[model samples]
Target chain A: MKARAFSYFRAATIEQALDAHALVGDDARFIAGGQSLVPALSLRLQAPRLLIDITHIGELRGVRREGGFLRIGALTRHCEMLSEPLIAEFAPLLQAAAPFVAHPAIRNRGTFGGSVALADPASEFPAMTLALDAEIEIAGPSGSRRIKADDFFIDLFETALQPGELITAIYVPLFKADQRFAFDEMARRRGDYALVGCGMLATCAGDRINDIRISFFSVGNTPTRVKGAEATLIGSSLNSERIAAAQAALEGDLAPPENDEVPPAMRLHLARVLLGRLLGRLGESA
Target chain B: MSGFDENLLDEADETVRVRFVVNGRKVACEVAPRETLVDCLRNELELTGTHAGCEMGACGACLVQLDGRAVHSCLMYAVQADGARIDTIDGLSESGVIADLQAEFHRRNALQCGFCTPGMLVNANELLSQVAEPSREEIRDALSGNYCRCTGYEAIVDAIDAVAKARNEGGSAT
Candidate 1:
């Protein structure tokens, strides 16, 4: 199906993008990479009056280290996640998940920030952000603010972004030497949306878990952090018994929505199985 | 029909002028704001090799090189590609960049109806460029997005694997 006709504006700067969106308000969309938004347009799921192309905005580009965090620009494409050295050194979790985000072509144009901003429940990057304790930087007419990834995603395809506000960058705390991470998902196909996916970052001290954050996607409305399971593994070394305990704790954490294709019980079961596999891998790495 | 307002169609009539380099040649076109790069390439420039199987990014049929990177042209509006360089399957074939790969595919009978061959070739070219000697598993992984209803993918993987070996050996000799 063809997309409904609309007007287009190429914004050279962040301020120009904000101004363009503000002028059209709810009728306008700030497009970067255009991976998710363009498909929505063609499907007629969303028909905006104006598309403010932010790809040319000079400020929203690059990957660099800022203080203790890795500042990943909003326009940083998915392919860059696999190629960027800083990401490999500091935010290795993102690098691990990058190959699984989509195929090479989609990865070539899909942006990290765009994926996080879209907040699709089945996507990998948003959930990985939670695992990394990343912060989302925003720019708007009233100026800018940073929101934690934990609070940025509200619901299905929903974010904390206000009208005319644009996600400028994502700031992830640099991965330290003591940290280890693992990410995996079970998809029918290699690049299809996962039936159940999870990513975890853990701080270890001689095999004893000092601190760990676990996030699971494709389970519910938002990427879920299994705090119960995380608490179960903290201060303890990963053994079969410990992994079993953590797997059991998932029942309390996730209530997978009922669906015909994959029943809620099956999804929850897959979540447990996935948690076991990821934690087992993490243990091996540690 | 009598009450249909002609002014309501005004937005559809609006066109944006975009200029870009396609397959080593400069091209210009006027397109509606919602017109995708795939549509622009096929309808305006007659580059039909870049098929549009699924408008969404899921299907790799619309893959093209945008600034040297293979991307889903269907997922991008024409206006967004202004001043960028695009290379479609026709361009790549004419340039003989994938001549060896194409010959291998043809020899192995990797494609049946050939609807998915263009995207497969584009994606395979991308993978070979990055990894000189990709294993069969790597070739299969690279083709995750490009769907082929024919040949069951074994022949396609074999063809890519063969080309990788040939290219690597050729490279090492020089």
Candidate 2:
């Protein structure tokens, strides 16, 4: 399949990119890495009149620690998550999820911001961001604003990102000394989109889970955090009975959708199984 | 309206000049914004060693090294690769970087139909370069993106594993 003809503009600066997008209005799209956007464009699912290449924008290209958070540029490729020392040190969950994010070739070209901005329900980074309690930085015609990962995702294939808004970077809270993290997903094949995936970040006081965030993807319209499951383990020790209770509490948290390939019942069952397995790992590590 | 509707699709032939290095040689060409690198390589330059299968980026048939990074050529627009260095299957094979792996593939019969060979070699090169001695599982993980309908991947894995072992042996054996 071939994409419809579109005008192209390479942006050297974020301001140039924003200005170009504003000039084209809804007829333009910002392309970085292009792993997702190119596929959509080829399938003719999206045909913007102008494609503003943001890969060359120097300002949106590196990772740095600012204050209490590690700021990851929107243009950060998925493969970078595997090797970037900052990501490995600050956001290990994203690093763990990197290998599971598509094949090596796609990972080389897919950007972290592109995945989060696209907000595909099945993607790993968005859910990992939610687990890490990251904030998404956005720049648009109305200046810039930061939205928490929890509030960024609105629905399936939809986000709080307004039209013409560019995700400049993702600011993830630095991993703490006491934080214990684990990430896992069950897919039919190695690089296939996961049937069910989950990530957990818990701050522990001895064996007790002081504060925990458990997030699941490929289970709902948006990457979801199981607050009910988190509640069951918040004050409790990592024990069999507590883990079972949290697994049982998953019913109140996620309602995975049914499709021709996978029924809702099966998806929910997989989600529960995945949750148990991830929690089991956390419990062992604890 | 559909995205490919004739009336909606622009046929203005708008093109931009892009200069990129392919196979260690600098090349400049005029390409449309919609032209994928695979298409540019196959159609414009007649460098047909890079095949175009599942242009949607699922198949690794169009794998190429862009700035030493293995990427699906079909997923990238030519304009996006402007000023980047590319190493295609032909280039890598010609340079002898993967000569031993190629010999192993031939010895192991990694290809039944041979359609996925070029891309497989490109991916294997990247894997060997990154991982000093990749295990069978690691080779499988690295080549997960590449689809080989024929061969069932066992021979392909055998070839890569053999190459890794041979290389790890301090080049004592071929």
Query: What TM-score does each of the candidates earn?
Result: 0.96, 0.97
Candidate no. 2 TM-score: 0.97
Superposed Cα deviation of residue A264, candidate 1 (Å): 0.9
Chain A of model 2, TM-score against the native? 0.98
Looking at candidate 2 chain A, the ten consecutive residues that score lowest on lDDT are: A15-24
DockQ of 1: 0.43
Badly placed stretches (over 4 Å) of model 1 are B1-12, B171-174
Highest DockQ, which number? 2
State candidate 2's DockQ: 0.44
Calculate DockQ per candidate and list them: 0.43, 0.44
Model 1, A145-168: lDDT tens digits are: 999998998988889998788899
Across A55-92, the per-residue lDDT of candidate 2 in tens digits comes to: 98878889999999999999999999999999899888
Q: Give residue B61's lDDT in candidate 1 (0 to 100).
A: 87
What shift in Å separates residue B93 of candidate 2 from its native position after superposition? 1.4
